[model samples]
Target: MEERTRAYLRGRFGDYYRRTELTPPPGANEREWGFIPWTSGPGTTMVRHRSLLDLGSIEDFLARKRPRHVYFSAGRYDEPSASSMSEKGWRSSDLVFDLDADHLPSVTLGEDSYAEMLAKCKDALLRLLDFLEDDFGFEDLTIVFSGGRGYHVHVRDAGIQGLEREARREVVDYVRGIGLDIDEIQTKEMRGNTPARVIEKDGGWGSRIHQRLTALSDDLKRMDNEEALGRLSEIEGVGDKTAKTILGAVSADQDVEGYTENEEVEINYEAISAGNIELGGVGMRKLIDAIAEETVSAENAPIDEPVTTDTNRLIRLPGSLHGGSGLAVRRIDRSDLADFDPLVDAVPETFVGHEISVEVTDGGTVELRGDSFTVEEGVHSVPEYLGVFLMARGRAEKGQE
Candidate 1:
């Protein structure tokens, strides 16, 4: 099982390492070990005296692998006091490195969907990459496997000292954006008989932007295909139908510049790519406006009538979300506050910490990033309790049975 997990980690995170974490002895509370003074800076060393994997040899692991980034993360939660796993709930789904508790949705979907959960994992990472590349521009992000079922992605370019609290906050929002998309995962309303292809299934909106950016950050490698699509489908203002329209244009390889905002939208990637420099805003706008209207057909006019690619550029749009190039947001700063350690004093701070985030780029492509590695459980948690319950009954009710 561990080996399979390791293989998946290596495949998902191009640059990363797997390390076991040590903790306090059998009976000692993690608090007994004392704290590692952290005002948030690069190269602040952490201590690990006991664990599934040893931390004492971490330097050797890094030296051997020569990885660019080292991220820590995990899927299970251990006993709150000692950082032990024996007494905790077996979490099927993971929260990963979102320590701040900000952006933690109140939704309790313990059984509604597993595919949805996995897709969310991917989208969360996609959003993270978007922010990391656009906002920080930090390069060579690598993830680490900190044992257990979690993972982390480390930005080797910026150590702890390099990452300020504000930057951490941005990361948290990015992650939340990914998770927030859970509200829109493949609902009944999204499927349709008319669902021909929107964007090419493999190469869609996010992929288009991802390919456009050179020096793709290691942070982006963590995103899987399903995650990217989840994000494309959940672009806030770009409802299901419209998001598909925009994605189709991108898949068709249309240049974003040629896209005009009007009642209808149109685009022809082959035309734009051919250097039809004359195809300016007016032409682009007309195409965009006519995109969704069935009434606006080739009968009125066709680019072929003028110049082969000149007026042939109109690509259709959905009547909804993709109506324009505009995007929408409910809370900008709300997501930004996600990663702050509001309860730093309460948790042990030991970690297998990997995470995901969201970022906006290219005015339309919302990117998600998965902190591509793992960190173990810290020494402690503040609330003094983790939600757990066990009950027994003499009789089984109809639904309970």
Candidate 2:
């Protein structure tokens, strides 16, 4: 790390340690805390079997050592220690969901920049939160900004604590919409001489399909025939023939006539006939299923699967500083998350208004307090928040402008 970066970390570690919550994992007398005292250190120094009775000791230790990184295990233990899990007899751990922009391929951070990447991850995090709370009916959950490029949702529901690794993997899969079968989700209805159509059902993936299809229908209406066909074909299972059929059906100037007793609907096939190409019940069903699958795939949260699956994972302590970004790992209220800007909200009070000079080592753009600026290769005077941020990222070094 740069000298100034190290100095900033050293100065702020005490306040961070004091403010950060040091809650041990459930049912544990001691929690294992790990620290990286220096950036060039061989590896993390494990400080285990620490009694949680005194927060003062941990604070004092942090003030003296001034670690570049701080972390604590999710797993609770009878006797928490790094040397042996057998000795500890692992009791239980909170189910952790790590939503990271680094894992998401949708956004290229090099071009989109960190702010955009963070926004993408935050949106995914909110969706995951909805899935956990409204879908899975989980209530005791904690949300934390990971201090770097993402967020962490910690499920503290007592029922979920003892879930095995495979069980946890299932939860991760559900959130990611992995291996969801569209065939099983869509409701098939036989309507007169026309082909069977798949209608969206009430819950689970069905509701998602319905929502996406509704939006897609509106969007398709605005596009020309070629554009509409191209858009439909972009869906995973939608082929050229299926896309053309969907485009024809959507473009046809005919309202869904009426529903039968079974809610099987009828469409005017005459209106949909663009040349000799006609859509049958089976073909229409296939197109709808394909669109549903595409919707589900797009809606899947870009979370790090391994983090959620690992029962014994160690996560960054909340209110601690992230070594890579010099931002505080902040505990966020679910209500305030919509307006929370991590760059502005997670900055430490110590560096809030202070000014510092730094030399840009890496060329890129950075956003601070809603202002965007290009990072040129040279020294420049910046606020303490941005200065420490760039230095921590190794993008800038301490120097006179």
Candidate 3:
């Protein structure tokens, strides 16, 4: 970045801090603070290992430094300003999950637009929330848009605050569905002295698979006889005879486990509820295994595992500007996350309602604030917000006044 551009961004950042009163993270004094100042270089330098006291008040420090980016340590410490990790008496750290769009498998880079990438990231966020909220039963959660390419979820539940790295890794594995074995989800029921293994129905992966199987049953029930038969035969191991047997099992004479006479019940609910899906049939077992894989893929949240395990990681501060994108690292309320648009909602009000001239160094289609337009390689006057975004992204330079 040019010196002129750096100076302009720095000055505007200072203005933003002067008017914006940022709420410090809990235990602010016990957490280390870091910031990246606008420097005349291609790479950034992180000024870290400073406590809240070293920076004075968050507001005053921001106004004075006008940093390019700001962050707070997820780990709280006794000697927060200590120069080394061993000296910083560690207490506890929030369980942090980072979902980056660039890392998402669904996203096809160079094809997906910024808006599309962000939308996919939001989908991933919802899946992550499902694991944290429904599976883990965590209540104290803070969600933030990273302002550059992803989202961050901070789990501040007191119960998990002091979890060591290995324990945190276990949490990560659960959410990511790593090393998940269907056999592990089974429970043994003692029938006399002999034990019988059954798939669980109450919670966790077993419950998820059961729900999927039930949904499949409902879908088959809705289909015509020929359609359902064709669908059943399409399963990898289900032959014509096997499919008919499965149909007969569904349309059994008895109503035990909700399978009434002449009713087409694809799954053996009696066996499933008893945690013995294998009793459903060989074809049914194959179908259940396929559904289990699908359930894991569909439900598991692909979060950055290292972030959750790292005790002393520096995370971008909420409500602070991301220097790379010139957008706010916004704290999004859970209720409003469904409609949050990072391109539009994360644009800083400090850069809105104004026009600025900039030299288009490496221009292309730019999308921001609910509009999309193409910019060629030349000097042009545009909205301050767009200009700042382009400048921060290194696609444009500040034009002469």
lDDT of each: 0.26, 0.70, 0.83
Residue 393: error of model 2 in Å? Answer: 0.8
Tens-digit lDDT track of model 3 for 275-370: 354444664566666677777788888888889999898999999999989999999999998889899999989899989999999878988999
TM-score of candidate 3 against the unseen true structure:
0.87
Lowest-sum lDDT 10-residue window in model 1: 387-396
Once superposed on the true structure, which residue ranges of model 1 sit more than 4 Å away at CA?
1-119, 126-156, 170-401
Top lDDT: which candidate number?
A: 3
Candidate 2 lowest-lDDT run of ten: 269-278
The whole-model C-alpha lDDT of candidate 2 against the native structure comes to 0.70
Q: TM-score winner among the candidates?
A: 3
| TM-score to native of every candidate shown | 0.24, 0.80, 0.87
